[model samples]
Target: MTDLTEHEVLVRPRAAPEAPAGRTTGWWAMVLFISTEAATFAAILASDFYLRFSAKGSWPPTSEKEPDLVLPTTATVIILVSCLPMLLGSLAAARGSRAGGLLGTLGAFAGGVAFLVLQIVDWLSEWPDSTVSKDAYGSLFYAITGLHAAHVLIGVGMLAFLLVSLAVRRAAARPRGPVSLVAMYWYFMGVVAVAVYVTVYLSATLWATR
Candidate 1:
Protein backbone atom coordinates (compact mmCIF):
# COMPACT_ATOMS: atom_id res chain seq x y z
CA MET A 1 0.00 0.00 0.00
CA THR A 2 1.18 3.46 -0.80
CA ASP A 3 2.13 5.48 2.26
CA LEU A 4 -0.39 8.13 3.21
CA THR A 5 0.73 11.67 2.55
CA GLU A 6 0.86 14.22 5.39
CA HIS A 7 -2.05 16.10 3.83
CA GLU A 8 -4.14 12.86 3.54
CA VAL A 9 -3.67 11.20 6.92
CA LEU A 10 -6.24 8.55 7.91
CA VAL A 11 -8.52 9.69 10.68
CA ARG A 12 -10.58 7.46 12.96
CA PRO A 13 -14.26 8.37 13.19
CA ARG A 14 -15.39 9.65 16.56
CA ALA A 15 -17.81 7.43 18.43
CA ALA A 16 -21.33 8.70 18.99
CA PRO A 17 -22.07 10.16 22.43
CA GLU A 18 -23.78 7.86 24.88
CA ALA A 19 -27.48 8.44 25.35
CA PRO A 20 -28.62 10.27 28.47
CA ALA A 21 -29.83 8.03 31.32
CA GLY A 22 -33.23 9.69 31.20
CA ARG A 23 -33.73 8.38 27.66
CA THR A 24 -32.29 4.94 28.23
CA THR A 25 -33.13 2.00 30.48
CA GLY A 26 -34.13 4.20 33.36
CA TRP A 27 -36.75 5.99 31.27
CA TRP A 28 -38.31 2.77 30.00
CA ALA A 29 -38.35 1.33 33.49
CA MET A 30 -40.22 4.38 34.81
CA VAL A 31 -42.72 4.08 31.97
CA LEU A 32 -43.28 0.40 32.74
CA PHE A 33 -43.70 1.14 36.43
CA ILE A 34 -46.28 3.81 35.69
CA SER A 35 -48.14 1.47 33.36
CA THR A 36 -48.36 -1.28 35.97
CA GLU A 37 -49.53 1.19 38.62
CA ALA A 38 -52.13 2.64 36.27
CA ALA A 39 -53.47 -0.84 35.56
CA THR A 40 -53.74 -1.57 39.28
CA PHE A 41 -55.68 1.64 39.88
CA ALA A 42 -57.94 0.94 36.92
CA ALA A 43 -58.79 -2.52 38.21
CA ILE A 44 -59.61 -1.21 41.65
CA LEU A 45 -61.79 1.59 40.26
CA ALA A 46 -63.60 -0.86 38.00
CA SER A 47 -64.30 -3.08 40.97
CA ASP A 48 -65.70 -0.10 42.84
CA PHE A 49 -68.13 0.63 40.02
CA TYR A 50 -69.10 -3.01 39.61
CA LEU A 51 -69.81 -3.40 43.30
CA ARG A 52 -71.76 -0.15 43.33
CA PHE A 53 -74.05 -1.18 40.49
CA SER A 54 -74.45 -4.79 41.62
CA ALA A 55 -75.25 -4.11 45.25
CA LYS A 56 -78.97 -4.21 46.08
CA GLY A 57 -78.90 -0.96 48.05
CA SER A 58 -77.40 2.53 47.94
CA TRP A 59 -73.91 2.99 46.57
CA PRO A 60 -72.32 3.68 49.93
CA PRO A 61 -74.46 0.93 51.52
CA THR A 62 -76.37 3.48 53.67
CA SER A 63 -74.12 2.85 56.67
CA GLU A 64 -71.18 4.53 54.94
CA LYS A 65 -71.24 8.17 53.98
CA GLU A 66 -70.18 9.36 50.55
CA PRO A 67 -66.68 10.83 50.46
CA ASP A 68 -66.53 14.57 51.01
CA LEU A 69 -65.21 16.41 47.99
CA VAL A 70 -63.69 19.39 49.80
CA LEU A 71 -60.47 18.03 51.27
CA PRO A 72 -59.62 15.66 48.44
CA THR A 73 -60.32 18.38 45.90
CA THR A 74 -57.88 20.63 47.71
CA ALA A 75 -55.30 17.84 47.82
CA THR A 76 -55.82 17.21 44.12
CA VAL A 77 -55.27 20.86 43.36
CA ILE A 78 -52.04 20.87 45.33
CA ILE A 79 -50.79 17.76 43.53
CA LEU A 80 -51.55 19.17 40.09
CA VAL A 81 -50.01 22.52 40.93
CA SER A 82 -46.91 20.76 42.27
CA CYS A 83 -46.43 19.16 38.87
CA LEU A 84 -45.72 22.58 37.42
CA PRO A 85 -42.59 23.24 39.48
CA MET A 86 -41.35 19.75 38.84
CA LEU A 87 -41.68 20.23 35.11
CA LEU A 88 -39.97 23.58 35.25
CA GLY A 89 -37.18 22.29 37.47
CA SER A 90 -36.58 19.26 35.28
CA LEU A 91 -36.40 21.45 32.25
CA ALA A 92 -34.02 23.76 34.07
CA ALA A 93 -31.81 20.87 35.14
CA ALA A 94 -31.68 19.57 31.60
CA ARG A 95 -30.45 22.99 30.64
CA GLY A 96 -27.83 22.84 33.42
CA SER A 97 -29.54 25.06 36.00
CA ARG A 98 -28.88 23.44 39.34
CA ALA A 99 -30.52 26.21 41.37
CA GLY A 100 -33.74 25.85 39.44
CA GLY A 101 -33.72 22.13 39.95
CA LEU A 102 -33.20 22.53 43.69
CA LEU A 103 -36.00 25.05 44.02
CA GLY A 104 -38.35 22.86 42.02
CA THR A 105 -37.51 19.80 44.07
CA LEU A 106 -38.20 21.75 47.27
CA GLY A 107 -41.55 22.97 45.93
CA ALA A 108 -42.58 19.47 44.97
CA PHE A 109 -41.58 18.09 48.33
CA ALA A 110 -43.57 20.76 50.17
CA GLY A 111 -46.65 20.12 48.06
CA GLY A 112 -46.43 16.40 48.66
CA VAL A 113 -46.19 16.94 52.41
CA ALA A 114 -49.16 19.26 52.27
CA PHE A 115 -51.18 16.70 50.38
CA LEU A 116 -50.35 13.93 52.82
CA VAL A 117 -51.40 16.12 55.70
CA LEU A 118 -54.74 16.87 54.06
CA GLN A 119 -55.27 13.21 53.27
CA ILE A 120 -54.58 12.22 56.84
CA VAL A 121 -56.99 14.83 58.07
CA ASP A 122 -59.65 13.55 55.72
CA TRP A 123 -59.04 9.98 56.82
CA LEU A 124 -59.39 10.98 60.45
CA SER A 125 -62.64 12.75 59.72
CA GLU A 126 -64.00 9.59 58.14
CA TRP A 127 -62.58 7.21 60.70
CA PRO A 128 -65.64 7.49 62.96
CA ASP A 129 -68.01 6.71 60.10
CA SER A 130 -65.87 4.40 57.96
CA THR A 131 -63.26 1.79 58.57
CA VAL A 132 -61.74 -0.87 56.38
CA SER A 133 -63.54 -3.68 58.26
CA LYS A 134 -66.92 -1.87 58.22
CA ASP A 135 -68.13 -2.71 54.71
CA ALA A 136 -67.28 -3.06 51.05
CA TYR A 137 -67.64 0.66 50.43
CA GLY A 138 -65.30 1.54 53.27
CA SER A 139 -62.79 -1.11 52.28
CA LEU A 140 -62.67 -0.04 48.63
CA PHE A 141 -62.54 3.63 49.49
CA TYR A 142 -59.62 3.23 51.88
CA ALA A 143 -57.84 0.80 49.61
CA ILE A 144 -57.91 3.13 46.60
CA THR A 145 -57.18 6.36 48.42
CA GLY A 146 -54.65 4.82 50.79
CA LEU A 147 -52.78 3.20 47.92
CA HIS A 148 -52.61 6.54 46.19
CA ALA A 149 -51.39 8.23 49.37
CA ALA A 150 -48.65 5.64 49.64
CA HIS A 151 -47.54 6.47 46.10
CA VAL A 152 -47.45 10.18 46.87
CA LEU A 153 -45.42 9.44 49.96
CA ILE A 154 -42.92 7.53 47.90
CA GLY A 155 -42.71 10.34 45.38
CA VAL A 156 -42.16 12.81 48.18
CA GLY A 157 -39.30 10.72 49.47
CA MET A 158 -37.78 10.66 46.02
CA LEU A 159 -38.07 14.42 45.73
CA ALA A 160 -36.40 14.82 49.11
CA PHE A 161 -33.52 12.69 47.95
CA LEU A 162 -33.24 14.73 44.79
CA LEU A 163 -33.28 17.91 46.81
CA VAL A 164 -30.47 16.72 49.01
CA SER A 165 -28.48 15.50 46.05
CA LEU A 166 -28.83 18.79 44.23
CA ALA A 167 -27.86 20.70 47.31
CA VAL A 168 -24.75 18.62 47.89
CA ARG A 169 -23.55 18.14 44.35
CA ARG A 170 -21.77 20.71 42.28
CA ALA A 171 -23.57 22.27 39.37
CA ALA A 172 -21.30 20.58 36.87
CA ALA A 173 -21.80 17.23 38.57
CA ARG A 174 -25.59 17.34 38.74
CA PRO A 175 -27.36 14.68 36.70
CA ARG A 176 -30.41 15.54 34.68
CA GLY A 177 -31.49 11.91 34.64
CA PRO A 178 -32.70 11.74 38.23
CA VAL A 179 -34.49 15.07 37.97
CA SER A 180 -36.29 13.99 34.84
CA LEU A 181 -37.25 10.65 36.34
CA VAL A 182 -38.55 12.21 39.55
CA ALA A 183 -40.50 14.80 37.59
CA MET A 184 -42.15 12.09 35.55
CA TYR A 185 -43.06 10.18 38.69
CA TRP A 186 -44.48 13.37 40.25
CA TYR A 187 -46.64 13.92 37.18
CA PHE A 188 -47.95 10.36 37.46
CA MET A 189 -48.83 10.90 41.10
CA GLY A 190 -50.76 14.06 40.20
CA VAL A 191 -52.74 12.19 37.59
CA VAL A 192 -53.53 9.32 39.93
CA ALA A 193 -54.64 11.78 42.63
CA VAL A 194 -57.17 13.32 40.23
CA ALA A 195 -58.38 9.90 39.17
CA VAL A 196 -58.85 8.89 42.80
CA TYR A 197 -60.80 12.07 43.52
CA VAL A 198 -63.04 11.53 40.54
CA THR A 199 -63.60 7.84 41.14
CA VAL A 200 -63.81 7.70 44.91
CA TYR A 201 -65.70 10.96 45.43
CA LEU A 202 -67.34 12.42 42.34
CA SER A 203 -68.41 9.26 40.55
CA ALA A 204 -69.82 7.68 43.68
CA THR A 205 -71.96 10.76 44.36
CA LEU A 206 -73.18 10.89 40.78
CA TRP A 207 -74.00 7.18 40.76
CA ALA A 208 -75.97 7.54 43.96
CA THR A 209 -78.01 10.35 42.44
CA ARG A 210 -78.76 8.21 39.38
Candidate 2:
Protein backbone atom coordinates (compact mmCIF):
# COMPACT_ATOMS: atom_id res chain seq x y z
CA MET A 1 0.00 0.00 0.00
CA THR A 2 1.92 2.97 -1.29
CA ASP A 3 -0.46 5.92 -0.97
CA LEU A 4 1.74 8.86 -0.05
CA THR A 5 1.23 11.30 -2.93
CA GLU A 6 0.71 14.69 -1.25
CA HIS A 7 -0.21 16.49 -4.49
CA GLU A 8 -2.87 13.93 -5.46
CA VAL A 9 -4.32 13.82 -1.92
CA LEU A 10 -4.39 17.60 -1.58
CA VAL A 11 -5.65 18.43 -5.10
CA ARG A 12 -8.17 15.56 -5.52
CA PRO A 13 -10.56 15.94 -2.62
CA ARG A 14 -13.83 14.33 -3.54
CA ALA A 15 -16.19 16.64 -5.42
CA ALA A 16 -19.34 17.69 -3.61
CA PRO A 17 -22.39 15.74 -4.62
CA GLU A 18 -24.80 17.45 -6.99
CA ALA A 19 -28.19 18.43 -5.64
CA PRO A 20 -31.00 16.01 -6.29
CA ALA A 21 -32.73 16.35 -9.63
CA GLY A 22 -36.06 16.27 -7.82
CA ARG A 23 -35.59 19.85 -6.69
CA THR A 24 -35.22 21.10 -10.25
CA THR A 25 -38.15 18.99 -11.35
CA GLY A 26 -40.26 20.35 -8.54
CA TRP A 27 -39.38 23.93 -9.51
CA TRP A 28 -40.27 23.38 -13.16
CA ALA A 29 -43.50 21.72 -12.10
CA MET A 30 -44.37 24.79 -10.09
CA VAL A 31 -43.66 27.04 -13.03
CA LEU A 32 -45.94 24.94 -15.18
CA PHE A 33 -48.63 25.05 -12.51
CA ILE A 34 -48.43 28.81 -12.30
CA SER A 35 -48.59 29.16 -16.03
CA THR A 36 -51.69 27.03 -16.31
CA GLU A 37 -53.34 28.84 -13.46
CA ALA A 38 -52.57 32.18 -15.08
CA ALA A 39 -54.19 31.03 -18.28
CA THR A 40 -57.30 30.02 -16.37
CA PHE A 41 -57.49 33.41 -14.73
CA ALA A 42 -56.98 35.16 -18.03
CA ALA A 43 -59.89 33.28 -19.56
CA ILE A 44 -62.12 34.21 -16.67
CA LEU A 45 -61.20 37.86 -16.93
CA ALA A 46 -61.74 37.78 -20.65
CA SER A 47 -65.21 36.41 -20.17
CA ASP A 48 -65.85 39.15 -17.66
CA PHE A 49 -64.89 41.85 -20.11
CA TYR A 50 -66.92 40.21 -22.86
CA LEU A 51 -69.99 40.29 -20.69
CA ARG A 52 -69.28 43.86 -19.72
CA PHE A 53 -69.09 44.92 -23.38
CA SER A 54 -72.18 43.03 -24.49
CA ALA A 55 -74.51 44.10 -21.72
CA LYS A 56 -77.26 46.48 -22.80
CA GLY A 57 -77.58 48.26 -19.46
CA SER A 58 -75.34 49.75 -16.80
CA TRP A 59 -72.73 47.28 -15.56
CA PRO A 60 -73.57 45.36 -12.34
CA PRO A 61 -77.26 45.80 -13.26
CA THR A 62 -77.62 49.06 -11.35
CA SER A 63 -78.58 47.12 -8.21
CA GLU A 64 -75.30 45.88 -6.83
CA LYS A 65 -72.79 48.51 -5.95
CA GLU A 66 -69.34 48.15 -7.41
CA PRO A 67 -67.23 45.98 -5.17
CA ASP A 68 -65.79 47.79 -2.18
CA LEU A 69 -62.22 48.73 -2.96
CA VAL A 70 -61.01 49.32 0.54
CA LEU A 71 -61.27 45.78 1.93
CA PRO A 72 -59.86 44.03 -1.11
CA THR A 73 -57.14 46.60 -1.44
CA THR A 74 -56.20 45.97 2.16
CA ALA A 75 -56.24 42.23 1.60
CA THR A 76 -54.07 42.62 -1.46
CA VAL A 77 -51.61 44.66 0.50
CA ILE A 78 -51.51 42.06 3.26
CA ILE A 79 -50.88 39.17 0.91
CA LEU A 80 -48.20 41.06 -0.99
CA VAL A 81 -46.50 42.06 2.24
CA SER A 82 -46.69 38.46 3.37
CA CYS A 83 -44.53 37.47 0.42
CA LEU A 84 -41.67 39.48 1.88
CA PRO A 85 -41.61 37.42 5.04
CA MET A 86 -42.07 34.24 3.05
CA LEU A 87 -39.03 35.14 1.02
CA LEU A 88 -37.06 35.96 4.14
CA GLY A 89 -38.06 32.67 5.67
CA SER A 90 -36.90 30.78 2.60
CA LEU A 91 -33.60 32.60 2.70
CA ALA A 92 -33.18 31.97 6.40
CA ALA A 93 -33.88 28.32 6.02
CA ALA A 94 -31.44 28.09 3.14
CA ARG A 95 -28.83 29.77 5.31
CA GLY A 96 -29.48 27.31 8.17
CA SER A 97 -30.94 29.84 10.59
CA ARG A 98 -33.69 27.91 12.26
CA ALA A 99 -35.05 30.66 14.46
CA GLY A 100 -35.16 33.25 11.76
CA GLY A 101 -36.78 30.85 9.37
CA LEU A 102 -39.42 29.93 11.94
CA LEU A 103 -40.17 33.54 12.77
CA GLY A 104 -40.47 34.54 9.15
CA THR A 105 -42.67 31.56 8.39
CA LEU A 106 -44.90 32.48 11.29
CA GLY A 107 -45.18 36.04 10.09
CA ALA A 108 -46.13 34.89 6.59
CA PHE A 109 -48.69 32.47 7.97
CA ALA A 110 -50.34 35.18 10.03
CA GLY A 111 -50.54 37.49 7.05
CA GLY A 112 -52.13 34.80 4.86
CA VAL A 113 -54.71 34.03 7.56
CA ALA A 114 -55.46 37.72 7.95
CA PHE A 115 -55.98 38.07 4.21
CA LEU A 116 -58.33 35.10 4.15
CA VAL A 117 -60.32 36.53 7.04
CA LEU A 118 -60.67 39.83 5.28
CA GLN A 119 -61.80 38.03 2.13
CA ILE A 120 -64.46 36.27 4.15
CA VAL A 121 -65.55 39.53 5.65
CA ASP A 122 -65.84 41.11 2.25
CA TRP A 123 -67.87 38.18 0.96
CA LEU A 124 -70.21 38.43 3.93
CA SER A 125 -70.65 42.14 3.54
CA GLU A 126 -71.54 41.71 -0.12
CA TRP A 127 -73.69 38.64 0.27
CA PRO A 128 -77.29 38.49 -1.05
CA ASP A 129 -76.69 41.97 -2.39
CA SER A 130 -74.12 40.56 -4.82
CA THR A 131 -74.65 36.84 -5.03
CA VAL A 132 -74.03 34.33 -7.78
CA SER A 133 -77.70 33.86 -8.57
CA LYS A 134 -78.45 37.52 -9.07
CA ASP A 135 -76.98 38.20 -12.54
CA ALA A 136 -74.03 37.74 -14.82
CA TYR A 137 -72.29 40.53 -12.99
CA GLY A 138 -72.72 38.84 -9.67
CA SER A 139 -71.78 35.46 -11.04
CA LEU A 140 -68.59 36.75 -12.58
CA PHE A 141 -67.75 38.70 -9.47
CA TYR A 142 -68.07 35.66 -7.23
CA ALA A 143 -66.42 33.30 -9.68
CA ILE A 144 -63.34 35.44 -10.13
CA THR A 145 -62.88 36.53 -6.54
CA GLY A 146 -63.94 33.20 -5.10
CA LEU A 147 -61.51 31.24 -7.23
CA HIS A 148 -58.71 33.57 -6.23
CA ALA A 149 -59.74 33.27 -2.59
CA ALA A 150 -59.59 29.50 -2.86
CA HIS A 151 -56.05 29.77 -4.16
CA VAL A 152 -55.16 32.00 -1.23
CA LEU A 153 -56.65 29.47 1.17
CA ILE A 154 -54.50 26.76 -0.38
CA GLY A 155 -51.42 28.95 -0.05
CA VAL A 156 -52.21 29.63 3.58
CA GLY A 157 -52.44 25.91 4.19
CA MET A 158 -49.08 25.35 2.55
CA LEU A 159 -47.51 28.06 4.70
CA ALA A 160 -48.99 26.52 7.85
CA PHE A 161 -47.47 23.15 7.02
CA LEU A 162 -44.12 24.72 6.21
CA LEU A 163 -44.12 26.64 9.47
CA VAL A 164 -44.74 23.49 11.45
CA SER A 165 -42.03 21.64 9.58
CA LEU A 166 -39.55 24.42 10.19
CA ALA A 167 -40.41 24.50 13.86
CA VAL A 168 -39.90 20.77 14.40
CA ARG A 169 -36.88 19.98 12.24
CA ARG A 170 -33.25 20.57 13.09
CA ALA A 171 -31.49 23.25 11.06
CA ALA A 172 -29.40 20.78 9.11
CA ALA A 173 -32.35 18.49 8.58
CA ARG A 174 -34.88 21.13 7.69
CA PRO A 175 -36.26 20.94 4.15
CA ARG A 176 -35.16 24.07 2.34
CA GLY A 177 -36.48 22.88 -1.01
CA PRO A 178 -40.00 22.79 0.32
CA VAL A 179 -39.48 26.11 2.04
CA SER A 180 -38.44 27.74 -1.21
CA LEU A 181 -41.16 26.04 -3.24
CA VAL A 182 -43.85 27.16 -0.84
CA ALA A 183 -42.46 30.65 -0.91
CA MET A 184 -42.78 30.63 -4.68
CA TYR A 185 -46.38 29.53 -4.36
CA TRP A 186 -47.03 32.24 -1.77
CA TYR A 187 -45.60 34.89 -4.07
CA PHE A 188 -47.78 33.61 -6.87
CA MET A 189 -50.79 33.96 -4.60
CA GLY A 190 -49.80 37.54 -3.91
CA VAL A 191 -49.74 38.31 -7.62
CA VAL A 192 -53.09 36.62 -8.12
CA ALA A 193 -54.57 38.58 -5.23
CA VAL A 194 -53.55 41.84 -6.82
CA ALA A 195 -54.98 40.72 -10.16
CA VAL A 196 -58.24 39.70 -8.48
CA TYR A 197 -58.46 43.05 -6.73
CA VAL A 198 -57.85 45.05 -9.88
CA THR A 199 -60.06 42.94 -12.14
CA VAL A 200 -63.02 42.26 -9.85
CA TYR A 201 -63.01 45.39 -7.73
CA LEU A 202 -61.20 48.24 -9.38
CA SER A 203 -62.39 47.44 -12.88
CA ALA A 204 -65.98 47.51 -11.69
CA THR A 205 -65.60 51.09 -10.62
CA LEU A 206 -63.42 52.09 -13.54
CA TRP A 207 -65.66 50.77 -16.28
CA ALA A 208 -69.04 50.69 -14.63
CA THR A 209 -70.66 53.12 -16.99
CA ARG A 210 -68.72 52.20 -20.12
Best by lDDT: 1
lDDT of 1: 0.89
User: For each candidate, what TM-score against the reference?
Assistant: 0.88, 0.86
Give every collision pair in model 2. Answer: none
For residues 25-112, what per-residue lDDT tens digits would candidate 2 score against the true structure? 8789888998999899989988988998899888877898677888998999998998888888889878877777788778889998
Residue range 1-210, candidate 1, lDDT tens digits: 788676565474557998565457878999999999999999998998889888998887778877788998899999999999999999989998888888888899999999999999999989979999998899998999999999999999999888878888844375587899999999999989988999899988887787
Query: Which pairs of residues collide in model 1?
Result: none
Q: What is the Cα-based lDDT of residue 26 in candidate 2? A: 75
For model 1, what is the error of residue 19's alpha carbon versus the real structure, in angstroms, after optimal superposition?
Answer: 4.7
Candidate 2, residue 92: lDDT? 86
Worst 10 residues of 2 by lDDT: 166-175
Cα RMSD of all models vs. native, in order, equals: 3.6, 4.3
